[model samples]
Target: MTALAALVDFWDEEIDRWVSGHAGVSDRLQPWFESYRGRGHGEVRLDAFPEPYTGRLIGNSTPVVMLGLNPGAAVPRFQAPGGVFFEQLKTLRYSEWAATVPYASKEWESIAGPNRFYQNRFAFARRLLGEPNWSIANGVYFELYPYHSSGVNASMEPPGDVIREFVLDPIGDLDTQHVFAFGKPWFSVPARIGLPPGRVLSAKWEIPSREARIYSLPSGQDLIVMAQNGYAGPPGAGDTEALARAIGLR
Candidate 1:
């Protein structure tokens, strides 16, 4: 099987194991699951416990890959199991579901309508690629950590195999042009995947001053890591053109 197909199978098996209440899987995900469950915050929910990856999986066409710290609580709170979103997730599997049900789909919007986190994150792709909507955009999103949580737990370390197979190997094998990775923690990803360290560059958005570090992979694709400010908070209005120029997209 191809690397991408293998990755899909990996996700399917993991999700199945998780949903079936596999003791090992439950034990593995307990920390992250309980972290949000025990927080005593009404807004924090864990109906959707683990999400390994989302968005359109890379295929024949070269896609822009967006990397994030982890799956946020924002999505699962709405798209819980038994809902249309989760139904699609179960039927199509993640990669196929993501491809079929783009973030712009009414099915997604109906459940998680106008989510600031997703909107802000996808804004970079919409602006940089000049795609008017995320539905038509050619991209995929992966997380450094795959579990869902309201807040990032710096101490939580994903299994080494998960890191290698899910994140690093797919990244190395995919035919991608540019990878826009958000969060300071991800600066080490390129190096971990065998690329040299990246050089940091700063970009000023409407909110805070954000940094975009650029790395060139051996395959000649560029990996641009940015501060988590814009995506985690509000949309960085007018960041497109300037960011495009800074990252050599313009």
Candidate 2:
């Protein structure tokens, strides 16, 4: 199997282990699971929730990538394990799954609205790669922690081996030219991985006036990380476009 295929298999096995309640799995996920469990009735079973595994590989590498903290919470009915949505994830057919439209189904639309989160989040990529080329098939969207959570769990920390193997190892092979990481929490990841400290750029025009940091990877690529307050909402078109230009994305 190809390296990307093996990575997919790794994700599949990890998710399966989590859902099956296997030993050792809970240790990594316990804090978040316990937090969700505490909320009581009307809560979706953790197993029924979809795993975060969107993005395609072009012959084992991607030119661009996006990173996020974790998958946001959603109702189980929309992403049950045996359903079509989950099936797409299992097979890695993520063109529609990772598109700006996300799943491209009317049922999903009714439940999730227009997906402004992605539409807004992906604006920089759309500008850099053009609308047609800005997609998971062309790049990737990796979550530092792969599970779904309603809110940020300050107590949860992903295992070191998982980050080294599943994340950093794969990234090292990608030959990626650029990486865009959203949220402030991501600022610490590079440092933890032994990368040189990123340089913070001024973006005074941004609503709420957030700063963007740029890290030059050893592989000669750029990793641009941004943080925003929740109240300010996801980055808008102007915000992304200006940042893209600021970084010389052209």
Candidate 3:
């Protein structure tokens, strides 16, 4: 089936389960989920709330490989400023969501927090992936498009083994290679397998190995992979061109 259809089916089946299990959700949220027909911003923040995550994931196309991470509070809500209808939904709080999420007067703060996260993540990814100019031509920003998760719940820390069994393994079979690891916590399994933090892996975590090389930010400094491979020094003018070439995007 098409990507959108698959998303719809997945969300319909799974999101309700999450809502039923989470105590914070309220009856009021049911309407928002039922009525939500993909308005406002396209990106969905995967915090503890089941509604938004399920809604977005089931609605939007699957990202390359979701960059696994603990849920982020800075994730953008629809009430962000600068866009039309900005602050439109602020006065009312969605019962199924966290009180900390943007509502009414909190619009400014919500917009600011997640804006930075989105921008920084976008900028960093473009720079790292050698797509510095991707946004320039489009008259828009370069964003890390495919990252996914259950949302920002550090408390529900899934062990690497559990993550492997459930989330990562199922999606690993897809054509997409590369599961970018944001940090050490998410890097455990990928690192153990010698795959780069952001590259693809086999459906089973026990595949032999591949040439996935991990790197640090700004300058791909230090030993990214355990193997003392060459250090990626700070980017010089020529380095930009070289990195773009490395990713075959230039």
> Which candidate has the highest lDDT of all?
1
Q: What lDDT would each prediction earn against the true structure?
A: 0.62, 0.58, 0.33
TM-score of every candidate = 0.75, 0.72, 0.38
Error of 3 at 92 (Å): 17
Largest TM-score belongs to which candidate? 1
Clashes of 1: 0
If both were scored by lDDT, which would come out higher, candidate 1 or candidate 2?
A: 1
Give the alpha carbon lDDT tens digit for every residue of 29-138 in model 2. Answer: 44434432213232324555444445554453445677776666655665555654555555543433443234335766777666655555555566665475555345
**Model 3 compared with the native: what TM-score?**
0.38
Stretches of candidate 2 exceeding 4 Å from the true structure: 1-5, 15-45, 58-63, 81-84, 87-102, 130-139, 153-156, 159-161, 231-234
- For residues 1-250, write the lDDT of model 1, one tens digit per residue: 7667778877777666544544144554444334322243333344664566676665637566777776776465335655566666556666676675356677667776765556666666777766676454465777876655677534434444555566656776677667777776666556555667778766666545566678886557777777745343312647666677776677
